[model samples]
Target chain A: MTRQALPPGTLDDTDRQLLNLLQEPLPLTAHPFAAAAAATGLAEDEAVARVARLREVGAITRFGPFLDAAAMGGAFCLCAMAVPPGRFDEVVTLVNAHPEVAHNYERQHRLNMWFVLACERPEGIARTAARIGKETGLKVHLFPKLKEFFIGFRVVA
Target chain B: MKLDATDRRLLAATASGLPLTLRPFAEVGTWLGLPEAEVIARFAALQAAGIVRRIAVAPNHYAVGMVANGMSVWDVADEAAEDLGARIGALGFVSHCYLRPRSLPDWPYNLFAMIHGTSRDEVEAKRQQVAAILGPALRASDILYSTRILKKTGMRLVEGG
Candidate 1:
């Protein structure tokens, strides 16, 4: 079984149901929240308010449409770099400043700094990695997805 | 679907998030000066065309305390990689599984799976289960646990549009 920890918040049964419902594809209608309200047995106003509260408290990172970059003629790749310990902070700032860098993380490995680079250009991943390497003076390793077996995330609420 | 200027504008308006209101589509329409019905229709069309994967909430995994994230890389036979990948991807514990190009003479793994758990031990156990599934087909594998999230945000097409 997958291990999971309850999110921090004063949540009740209603909130848990709401979280699960929110992960679903919302109805695209004139009154979409109404559908959510119906599912959660809460008023439309209350449902919207609760979602807003969840976001404010950082329980929900984002609530909206998830766009597919590849389908939209964009490029993306996972990259890693081994930055010197002394220059880690400076390199992080430089890497994050680039709009092309989607997300980055520090991992427990020799090649520590890992990030996602995404852009509309077909060769954007390579170009961005090259630029990051030149700018940070660290060797950037590109790990682009050759094939997708699965791509989805769901947390048991 | 080919998104024109108007479609781009609409997506730009809600790229960060949908307006927190009873009628988010209508609100977006108001912001873009387009009819509410038109906005709703276009949004639906975008989804049908697969440009928009879905309208949903992305929960904060860390905030939820499922902090352990292990990027498991495996060296599987090139011929059987696809079949094994499909099986691994179907596992409930594997949040993301993909076949990534590996750099030869250095990085030798190709199959990658992003597994999440509440702790390192949990993630390691999950990795073992994945190995058990792979059996002898798994030549080699390694898990890289993320220590910190330096930056995180979804891909954006337009810059603050």
Candidate 2:
């Protein structure tokens, strides 16, 4: 079925329901959409459409399962860089190309560029950082997470 | 999303990492002593409730060689913050972007974007790109570099101490 295009900030009750669903997807099941619709009191088609619209509008980045790298014996670290004027885009492209890098961001500060990297092994993280520093010709600060305080929080809006 | 005991157990077990096996779900089911079908069913319920987000693999930037990272906070004009944020989010380098209410007396930046790079220079380059896009409207910004690795895990829906 063709879904109606979503208007800006025009989230209805159904839309909200869909958002709630996307926030937490059920286990991989045969009829996942149907299961979600049953819980949200919406039709399967409506649930699917709403999810699609939400993703299209960027409210939801993706609809998939989460992975635990540590469990897989992979290592990860959080790092940041200080970007000078007129060079942030070029740097980001370089960083994103690496297979280990997962998420990157632009923040407000001297150390303005931040990203997280996951590696097959723990030692690989530092090696990759050194490579980045050499390749980019800049000081890349490696901030390996020391102690995890708060893991993940959700916005209940 | 409202969660039951079984769902809670599933989340707690899988929050950190899924079992590294051919049938990860089957392994989880074995641990929980439930049938695979039941385990799968509860997971669906949790998702429908909006308690579980996406289930996808996140690349470890520090592993594959791209290493620079930062938490960029921007003091964007109230009127244009959302527009600029959406634009920044569209950038491939940016993984997560959101609008947060600035804290009083300490934090004035309402928009946050994450950028990653292979090196400090690379990240700086991306920062410049974002700055150019915002032009002069961006008053100030800060990049808080992570100092140490900490606990990263998925949220547990069931209430527990």
Candidate 3:
């Protein structure tokens, strides 16, 4: 398979390695990027510069520790709803207004609207669902994760 | 460990992202007026406690040419779902695999896996591979292809923040 071209003049070998290294936890030391820089055969300053550039160019969406809502005394649920094509935009506006709604995506199915709701409390999920349903006049189907076998990715950029 | 005022503030500072710097901890420390060692220690402790999953870069999958994304749902035997979920989750192409409750008479899928590829056909091929792996234990399945991403963000549910 042919590899797709990265954005023009965006990422280089060092950036790739740095991105991969960042996918793992950073060492709990004073100079975390130093280890990554050494591993990628780049100076610490250069590694930091490359990462900064990557962030500027949108190659890296976020560069920081990922926290789980559940672990932090919160709740999350995957939800789905069917909206007529005409009302898609309006529904989106209404649903996205909720701070609890973390992600909203349109999928190709009868239940076209799918989103993940994250709240500070487990009961908050159902309450938010009720609010969304009442506001949108559509039944919201909840799909809270019962067991997570795996839930992550490491894209080799 | 329970989060106090300082921890919440720390999380908020880096919620969007931490600065891409050589001494990221030092930078955060300087901004928060805490020592570099203390910043590192707190973050490490949070990670060990499972509050912070990992410090990493989140790539835009679409930019990386992973255009075809499908959320594959499956209805498997109640007793075998856990075993099958583990097997499915282990696949290289499966980014997220979980066992979720079925919506009863309206929806019957209890297992879900997210598959991304270059095209729909590729996703379908991977789905078939999962089918082969599950064999008779898999009762039913469907692939929900994402047509549009209206909005996507890491969870930010800090109360009153």
Writing each residue's lDDT as its tens digit, candidate 1 over A1-157 gives: 1124444555677877888788888888888888879988899999999989877776687888898778777788988887888999999999999998888989877778989988877677788888988998788888888888764467655
lDDT of 2 by residue, A1-157 (tens): 1112234465666666555554453447544566667888877777667666655454554344553334324677767678775887788778777777777766556666767777767888999898888878877776554222122323222
Single out the weakest 10-residue window by summed lDDT for candidate 3 chain A: A1-10
lDDT of each: 0.83, 0.62, 0.84
A best-first ranking of the candidates according to their DockQ comes to 3, 1, 2
Candidate 2: regions farther than 4 A off = A1-157, B103-106, B147-158
Tell how far residue B86 is off in model 2, in angstroms.
3.1
The full ranking of all candidates by TM-score, starting with the best, is 3, 1, 2
Comparing only chain A of model 2 with the true chain A, what is the TM-score? 0.67
Interface RMSD computed for candidate 2 is what?
Answer: 13.6
Best candidate according to DockQ: 3
Candidate 2 chain A worst ten-residue window by lDDT:
A148-157
Least accurate stretch of 10 residues (summed lDDT) in model 2 chain B?
B149-158
Model 3 regions lying over 4 Å from their true place: A1-5
TM-score of each: 0.87, 0.48, 0.89
